[model samples]
Target chain A: MITLNDLTQISETEWEIPQSFRSDMRGPVRIFATRELLDHVLTDKSLEQAVNATTLPGLVGAVTVMPDMHQGYGFPIGGVAATEFPQGVISPGAIGYDINCGVRLLGSQIDFETAKPHLDILATRLNQYCPSGVGKDGMVKVSIPELDQVLRDGTKWALKNGYATKADLARTEEGGAFKGADPRKVSERAKKRGKSQIGSLGAGNHFVEVDLVQDVFDEEAASIMGLKKGHLAVQIHTGSRGLGHQVCTDYVREFQSAVRRYDIQLPDRELVCAPMDSPEGAAYLGAMRSAANFAFVNRQLLAHAARRAFEETFAGKTKNWHLHQVYDITHNMGKIEVHEIQGERIKVCVHRKGATRAFGPGAPGLPPEYQKIGQPVLVPGSMGTSSWVLVGTEDSMMRSFGSSCHGAGRMMSRSKAKKKFHGDMLRLELGDRGIHIRAGSMKGLAEEAPDAYKDVNAVVETVSQAGIARKVARLKPLAVIKG
Target chain B: MPFEEISHTADWSIRVWADDLRGLLAESAQGMWMLTGTEQAEGPRVSREISLEAYDAESLLVVFLEELLYLSEFEKIVFDGFSDLVIEGEKISGIMEGSALRSMEKEIKAVTFHNLAIHESERGLEVEIVFDV
Candidate 1:
């Protein structure tokens, strides 16, 4: 029932719903969107949900919604909230059901000219070599015991199994492992569900795309990320799969009671949470970390799959197919991070659902190679559009708690998009533009039509102009595999 | 009754409501099962007993529904309806029967708390839930 009038425009890109709007609100709600995009926000209950998020207990700052914000159960997607450490409550809704759903970018030395003739074969090989579609299984099935180790060790397990290289780990966020993961906290059922689906590319919006670096804005940053104009790159968007979903599902109900026990008053029931120090919170955190770890390992496995596909297509010709990991980042997650809050450094659990971590230069978490520059921000565009590669900026730390927008952001609903556009027509249109499309379902395909999303180029322009992330390179899709 | 779709931006969700606590729970299970197209699920029948504790009526409702989702996806049991339900000191204990865990004909994936509510109204105990797809 909340209306757009409840929000005050802070800037062209920033909107705010102050704490006085509701009695239960502990903070304000901040949204990032253009006037055109606000229409989508107004069409649903997403803006209201964003306002409700301001009521979460121990919320330190405004409940921030990224430009890609949309209605989600509990917290809106592209939402970010930093609650005071041990005292603040951790809500699964804030972290999202797709725990650690994220993207990883691999830059290559080869250019489109070198890869163009073999593009068809390479696309077909990728489709064959990589197991995709819904409920698909891979060749590498681990035993129950081995799976448990993976839950605990994440990408380390993949590295140990020869599925990932040291360089892959070096370029990944947190080196592809969240140290707090405890497999014991993950339920037996979650374990079994994850066993068969470790390397799978599950259905619905998940994709593997081969792209060409179409433009480069910052020469130094582009060089650091190993991007050169016209070079080929790969992007994989997925997550912890069944394990993460189960973990979030398990905790949402758990935190419901925990919220009541603690007498936490929330404007929305979906924002149910408990103090981070409590047993329930600890349990959820442990389980969430395990799932995040699973996602990291899952991507590592998929990367290995991509590598094999390239090798099979090229035939011992890796010199031109030198795919190096640019960066891997999680968009939906809750991490215990130390940040300067009102001049004092305090540890806090930052829940970022559908938002990316844009750590500035000199951040401790960055790898040695990136410390001098900043974290590599991977922003995947809509299918057949331009995706971006950017580096975090110092201003991001002061402005957005070292976070930025995740994607181009949806401007239309699936049903509306399907009604407006035909999947067959879209495939033809994209094909004419030189982008290849392979999918499990055209119905699902129409749901993600590029026309349904905002121009990613514009989104990148906002973040770059706003000084949150410095644009490095822009990538145009060559081929896409969706499930 | 059929499972109903609810609005969720980043994910998908659904809801089911009933009068009594037992019926409310049964309908929630039914809604989730229907969402997953359980009638279409190809698997053998399996049975399991569930016990859950909560501090309040609303949380109890959530826990009850979550247990059903967990059982369906994990244990592969599609419990029809529980025979008995007893509420004591914020705890609800019941027995459910269903089918073996197998590939889901449709992936309901996860249940979410979006717009979740449990209350005693003119219709008795009214409950609503959202599922994350």
Candidate 2:
């Protein structure tokens, strides 16, 4: 286990665990957190997991973790690692089970004050319109062949099916589709699990929230993205569902032998990997991209559902009720990109698990409207708390591989949270504060209580102070829908 | 031996123990179901056979639990109990029986191999499994 004393503090918001600490590590681990947040991280194995991540062969630069870091299986949540392309290894565990699991923000012209009267019904409609909960099916079912198209085309399928708009695609990461996603590389079992899950929200921390843009810090940037203070916006937090989970499971299982075949040594079995140039690596990349594409459509369909809910609640009453795409970002993903590492520019596969890509201004692939600002980073807080909108900085591009914090990292266990807070009481508490809540399972609600997570404000502060991300706006929840 | 839910910062974890490797695997499966607050529906009992091969005991444990997880995910069926579990040289076969999952309070996303190791203790065999929920 790693302790704070072993870390060399670079700044109030940054710390480092040198490669010398572990002889097997190929690189050092850079952490973005204040002493207060680092104290919380030390209580768990988040730092140790980050150190384990450093051992990935061909690791370029330092393995950086966001302030929301929390122990999660092999690689800690909010961790980011970049490995040399086509040579370094890609570990499925490093990318996470929920491939392309991410957040989507939709800005609206409807002001919250004017929409307050319709809040309760909007929450109910969102829950009803968006299929959710365990064993829930999507709004539309596709045949196996059609599911392949969904995987191959991603948001293109959504656009063709009339579920998305051109602007939605333009504003999405990679334009809402990952190229080279060959469905043949995906497993039949993963396909079966994904076929029925498209457009559906599976349980466990996934939710749809209605928020009021409470404050805008960077007005020029916020205005360009169509975000205005006091206006209502929607946040959808979900991922590729069972298909992605199965893909990771299948690869993790298969890679067990691949590690032996490659003669690689690992501290944990979950981090099993193969050289990116190997057949196994090529297959996983193809299949992982397929899963990622599926997740893009998953969120797009949910966004379509949210739009419907918005229309039903505000159309007849207000003329300015339509919602526009702000941005969509995938937090749990591995993408091949070129970044500067110690004054050297080279290509690397950046693995971001519970970390969002926060590309700074002038970065390639961003929509024209955002070229002057930066890629919008959506950070959702625990239910009934504040969420944030941040943008990547040039410093982030240099120091953190263009990644930032994902959310309020969990500080307590679900079992402990459940034992400490009652779901029914939580509902009343949020209700007393004027936030409407609709949840499939009350027991599950207790497990995600606000107290279970660290202070999101503190997390945002650390990233902002560290020059990794800059705050644009803060949002307060008015209603939430959870599976 | 027995199984118990343990504290994991962000996900579900269970520490399972038994008299042997096979018992440990069975208990881990049961313990996972318990953690999800899963309830089986009243229906004709369903039985399924599972056969898996891995490189070691740890991999075997992951595959066994993953098979069960896949069933629950793909078919909405939870194999509450296992019988005739035989483990031999990284090859395990067993019979799982349960009813349709009526409802599940929480859904476990995936079974992870993080720090997963099956160990022999003076009392018996033990393992700690972390789950991505």
Candidate 3:
């Protein structure tokens, strides 16, 4: 087994395992972390996994691991890579099981000071309105064709069903739909899994929380996002659910053979991939995009459900509680983006696992209002901690493929956390802090306790220090809804 | 051996290993099939080429198994194992042959890292992997 002594420190924040260290590696593996974070990463095979990601076919740049990197199935969580378009392989493992597992932030009209009185009631209503937990079904029942449309159209389908509006779509990432998603590429089983999960939140680390925009770092950027100090917002984190999981599982195998057929060599099986131009690769992309679209619809419908919850909670209030979409970004996804690699503009399939797309201001893909401040990067912390609102930087576009850290990466395992903390104690602790939590299961709550994860402040500081992303605001949780 | 009545979730995982890269890969596939309850369908084998590359050995295992799942879903292939395991760096190239996946076939939806472990133990080499089916 490789030991910690094998690594050579490049910078205070970067660690490198050179290509000479392993003959199977196509390129070098670079990790961004402090010495303390590196100690935790070394406890598992995460560093080894990052090295394995370097073996992907036609990898153009060095494999990168973000500060929040953790051990995952194939590639380490928070890993990023770019492969040659059409020639580089796309492994489902690289994108992860949850296809578009992402975060969405909504800026509300009311301030936290005004909403504080109803915080407890709103948390309960949100948990009740949004279906969650294992084997949960969406509030909307869909037929086969309608479900296919949902898979194909994403948030646009929500607009058709009167679940969303044009403004909502405009505020979403990629306008709430990714192009080139063909539902025909999706399987029957995948379809079935997605049918009932369109507007539902699946269990295991998924959450919807009420947050207060506690601080703002950039007045101009914050103004564009309609953010003010003490204002309330909603952050929802989830993904494509079983449909995306099945899609990834189905494609990793297809590319396994394709990699051999193409005669490429690598160090890890989990990093298996086929050339992007190959039939197998194209099929996986099509299916992945479909899954991504499904996730977009899933989140949109969930927002619709959240709106309904508010409507029910305050039926005869002064004004309807509308949660306007601020931004939506998928952490686990591969997007075809053009970036300057060594001063040449090249198209690359940027695979971000447990990372967010932090396209800088004036980037082509962002919405009109956000063009000047860059894409709003929603980084949700562990329950009862502070999250962040970051904007992409030109430095990110030039240096790290317009990517930034996702959240307060896990430091402790679920079992370890469960053994150390009790659900009752955690509930009381959060309650003592005036943070109301409505969780489906107390056992689940204990697993996601704040201590189970690293500090969000440190994680954000790393990215800001790296200059890939700039902090815009810090959001503190008032209430949390865990599935 | 082909699996039978195997049921594993992303939450509950197992890791198996062998000396050669191919042997390790075949056993991993075998373990996964067993977890998915696919042992009951002892059908004719179909030859298919499977290849993958990772920066390390563990990630290679993950990609290899994911490929097995993909082939089973699309091509109806339920591979028992790989024969010629040749691994260099993170890339593992091998020949896999398995039965086709039918309606009655057990399917493993996804691979997870809930309780995953990989190491060289008394039983040659062993790995602990989780499946989310």
Give each model a TM-score. Answer: 0.90, 0.98, 0.82
Q: Write the per-residue lDDT of candidate 2 for residues A357-376, one digit (tens) a residue.
A: 99999999999999999999
Tens-digit lDDT track of model 3 for B66-114: 7676566556667775655567777876676677664322234476543
TM-score of chain B of 1: 0.75
Per-residue CA lDDT of model 3 for A115-220, tens digit only, reads 8788899999899888877556777889889988887788999898898889889988888888888888888878877876778887778888889999999988
After superposing candidate 2 on the true structure, give the runs of residues whose Cα lies further than 4 Å from its correct spot: none
Instruction: Tell me chain A's TM-score in each of the predictions.
Output: 0.97, 0.99, 0.97
Candidate 3 reaches a DockQ of 0.10
Count residue pairs with overlapping backbones in model 1.
9
Q: Between candidates 1 and 3, which one is better according to lDDT?
A: 1
Q: Model 1 segments beyond 4 Å from truth?
A: A1-4, A316-318, A418-425, B1-3, B15-106, B118-127
- Model 1 docking tier (incorrect/acceptable/medium/high): acceptable
Give the Cα error of residue A219 in candidate 3, in Å: 1.6
Task: Encode model 1's per-residue lDDT on A287-320: one tens digit a residue.
Answer: 9989999999998888898888777766554467
Residue B127, model 2: lDDT of: 90
